[model samples]
Target: MKKGGTAGTGATGRRGLLKRAAFGGVVAATGALAAPQVSRAQTVTWRFQSTWPARDIFHEYAADYVKRVNEMGGGRLRLELLPAGAVVPAFQLIDAVHAGTLDGGHGVSAYWFGRNKAFSLFGTAPPWFRDANNYLGWFHYGGGEALYNELITDILKLNVVGFQNGPMPTQPLGWFKNPIERVEQLRGLKFRTVGLATDLFNELGAAVVALPGGEIVPALERGVIDGAEFNNPSSDRALGFPDVAKVYMLQSFHQHTETFEILFNKPKFEALPAELKAILKYASESNSADMSWKLQDRYPKDLLEMTQRQGVRALTTPRPILEAQLQAWDRVVARLEGDTSSPAAGPFFKKVCDSQRDWCRRTGVFFLRNEAPSVLAFNHFFARG
Candidate 1:
């Protein structure tokens, strides 16, 4: 009887232990189901475009910006870059981005000059900057951003966010069918240029035709325009400028210093996480520095190739013409400053130009005075003895 009783007790205890174990298992599963699950962040993709033809170095520069952002973003963010005219024409980039047709774009601020002439003050007009780098310094540090915000938000009412990057070297006087030796040569010349440079050339007596970079070569080929300027040597070579024009006139005050503008839809950009926003900002900075280095390397090589091998005659634009361009800029500034009409470039134009000029007075003068003429160093080191 004692052995049977002990066996029954052990059996009962074993059953109780098994039931508790099963209950513990159910509780663990329930806890797991109730607790938050860990998963990867959802990847975001932006449809981006460039206001440049596919082959142009400008487009490549745009690609560089996109690459930096994408790699830094890892899988969390992706930017798909399309060439100009993929979704909208190059000039319409701001509008498209504003309307969410494109999430973002690479373009110059000057492209929006039609909306407000003050747009040119950001990167396209005046010779106040000692160089593109100085121009960028002004934009980033010299109260330019506040004014820019005012223009975009308070004035133009465009639903966009923009960052200024890609400091362009001084643009050339432009391409010509024949070398221009005199200021008089500009009169009645049909020239292709965009931005306030169009007004500058127009001021100098050229019948200005504002064509996008892609159309310049074709227009030149068809005799639709006689001369054009499209940024630097790599882009000029890429766009077949040599095939159409033999004389490449270098240096100009029109777009003395310029930078590319990277724009985003305000809503879309704001919707991004703080980490991603920081990525885009840093990416712009990275792109700017990288492009500066790359242009220093590539532009000289192409310029040499054009002059040495391609039978292209590259000439320094005559002093007379440059002085005349400066004068023209003065006139353009005055006219725009005086006009208080539809675009409201009058007071706004004065405001930006005054800011730039004050910044230049404090900064650019120092830069010019402190940096010895680079030509002297170039002649000392690289001059063929």
Candidate 2:
């Protein structure tokens, strides 16, 4: 029910701007990679390894992105996408890219939070940064992007090419074997989750495990984990989570929009002719838009099909479970704020929450009532166009 896409593109009504303004002239001005004619003669090929599994929507996005780039470049920029473990482990994409072993890589920006907790603030957090629009606004228009580039690129010195990959658009809470009745239900539960969810889950006395998508189903099926949360209905169902765990709870507060990032080695990016630089960015913007659109269309249908056709148990997280999670989230976030050791993620989270709360107070409550009509109208508009 929420929106997703490239920053400044999709449901936001900025497609025209992206096409005509964002990089229209930047590419031509960068004389090095010049017209597609010259680059096409040489056929510059690059390797792009991704952290996502082949079936993941985000992975689909990456594949589509490579195809589009190849087409648009007219045979100049050919990219070979290697799945996780092709070159480096799934979780080590940023490191691989930073090391310049590959031309570029696709991964979630916050997964590198271990390098600097501040990266977590850019991704997602519980009881905060709920809306996709708010997150985009903060990153692109607010000081968030400047702060991020400053820290990650300027300070940490990693070769970074960043773009927002997903909104996972209001994900399901998780699949629970038993209904969560209260805050205590979370206690001692081993959950496969990540980011701020891990901290929040910890506060509720749950142990959090960070597992790749491929591993989640096996872990849950084999009883290595009590419960788990993945992407939207489409992705989870595709991966067979519904078959393994029938009780699918909705509205996970932990990851409102799990942003996927594409990073390349800085030196590699810099070494490219300015024209290739512009081309890559333009290609990224287009691919990102396409990726988000697929989710916008598929998620709703998948959720409906899962319940109606597959007999999967799909329902919202109980109010009590959500309420309890909120309490624990607040406490944990507050404690994080008070801790000076590394409050980067915490304070940035507070700002994002403040912004979202203020926006919701002004417009979101009323907006929700009109969403059905809006979705219908918006869908028709895009379909016809």
Error of 1 at 32 (Å): 13
The superposed Cα distance between candidate 1 and the true structure at residue 288, in angstroms, equals 0.2
> Model-by-model lDDT, in order?
0.90, 0.72
Candidate 1, after superposition: displacement of residue 351 in Å?
A: 0.6
Clashing pairs in 2: 159-266
Tell me each candidate's TM-score: 0.90, 0.79
* Residue pairs in collision within model 1: none
- RMSD of every prediction: 4.2, 16.8
lDDT string, candidate 2, 1-385, tens digits: 2334454456356767666766777766775556666756888778898887788766777888778777766675678888878888877888778777888878776677667655766667454553765566556665666766776776577776666554447667788787665667778888988667777778879888888777899999899999998878877878888778778888767777666677767776778777767777788767756766888788889888888877777777777777777777778767766655664545654654465456445555566665677678878989785
For all candidates, the clash counts are 0, 1
Q: How many backbone clashes does candidate 2 have?
A: 1
Worst 10 residues of 1 by lDDT: 34-43
